[model samples]
Target: MDDKIILAEESLKRNGFQVKIFNNSEEAKKSLLESITTDESVAFGGSMTLSQLEIYDDFKNRGNEIYWHWKGEDRKKELAEAYKSKVYITSTNALTLDGKLVNMDGVANRVSSMFYGHERVYIIVGKNKISKDYDDARERIKNIAAPKNAKRLNINTPCKFTGKCNDCDSPDRICNVEVIIHRNPTGANINIYLIDEDLGY
Candidate 1:
């Protein structure tokens, strides 16, 4: 493993999160499959990273009940089902080298589930998402992830056209809620899986 990854894993471990590093997404996916049982109820937030990894179908093929608003016909019902699920999986916008998970969301469902309700939370991060510190991480989210995501979602925010954050008050702004997870939430078994490749915005 690279030194940065080692340092990150150690730091996350110190914060009481189960940390795993993979050389690629395939290895990470296999590890994820083995970690959860077939009958478990799995839920997910809106994550392009997980979509890139094709995890939803994998879990479904393995007989795990999935609740993802992106894949469901009914968004509200899916969100509710996801909240009640045993395992929640998602990706972070930025991960600090000092072991903090940072994310910006519009609806806040994804960030909300990371801290509570779920029995286990799996946060899969690509190496490109890692930042030197919290300030750098937040910047990455605002200037990089949020803008790119807004464009991807076709949101009529200034960032979507400018390729940068204007901190706009646009109704379609995706940067409504921001969450920073410094440590594992009480009674939650949180896992941080760091993948080598760049996978998401």
Candidate 2:
């Protein structure tokens, strides 16, 4: 493992989060499959990392009850179902080496699900998401992740065109809510899987 991965793993574990470091997405996916049972109910936030791993398809193929608003027919119903799921899987926008998880959300569901209504929360992140510290993590989200996401989603935000956050007040601004997870939420078992590969925005 790289020094950054080691530091992140140690810090996250010390901060009360279960941490796993994988050399690649395939190894991470294998471990993920082994961690959850076939009957477990799984939910997902909008995560390009999860999509890259095709985790949803794997879970669905295994007959696990999975809810993802992005893939569901009824967004409202799926969102409600996801809230009630046993496991919630998502990705963070930035992960600090000091054990902080940072994310910016538009609807707030992804951030909300991380802290409540789930027995276990699995956060999948790529090496590209790691930062030197909390402030660096925030900057990574604001200057890199958020801007790229806005352009990808075709949102009319200044960051989309400028490739940087202007702290815009646009209604379509995706960086509406900023969340920092310093420790595992009360009553939730948070597991973080750090993949060596760059898999998400």
Candidate 3:
């Protein structure tokens, strides 16, 4: 286990987040599937980590009501249903050592759901996404997370081509909204699952 990840877990726990450390994504996936009940509807945000976990398919096959925009053509309808689901699972762009979750979004749905409209929100974080502090977290999001996601989605944004944040004025900008969660949202149980692997951008 990396020292940084351990430190982050301590800090996040101090800040009132339920922190769990895993050796790898496979272990994390096993635990997630076992813990997240079929009785409660589950929702997922746009996350490479969750995609890699193949949780949507696993849950769908298990007869759990699932909602994710990436699953079908009805993105708007799916997004609405996702927000209303009992359990919300997603990932943060960056997790600071001092206990902060930093994220940037285009559609704003994922970011909003992080702090609202869910009985429980599970944040799956890979070791690569950890940072020293707030500034470092946001920096990585712009240069690393945002750019990679833009390229993956084939968006016509400068970051996608430049492999860095150009801070372009394009209407298709992925970082249209940003949020920094200093603590868990009111009336929501937030779980932070920290895996020691480079799972997502």
lDDT of 2: 0.91
Those runs of model 1 whose alpha carbons end farther than 4 Å from true positions after fitting are none
Can you write out model 2's per-residue Cα lDDT over 24-126, one digit (the tens) per residue? 9999999989999999999999988888889899999989999999899999999989999999999999899999998889999999998888999999999
The sequence of per-residue lDDT tens digits that candidate 1 reaches over residues 59-139 is 998789999999999999999989999999999998887888988999999999987998899999888888899999988
Alpha-carbon lDDT, every model = 0.90, 0.91, 0.91
lDDT (10s digit) by residue, model 3, range 128-167: 9999999999899999999999989998999999989988
Judged by whole-model lDDT over C-alpha atoms, candidate 3 comes out at 0.91
lDDT of 3 at 158: 95
Question: Which 10-residue window in model 2 sums to the lowest lDDT?
Answer: 179-188
lDDT of model 2, residue 18:
92
Task: Give the Cα-based TM-score of candidate 1 against the true structure.
Answer: 0.97
- Judge candidate 1 against the unseen true structure and give its global Cα lDDT, from 0 to 1: 0.90
lDDT: worst 10-residue window of model 1? 1-10
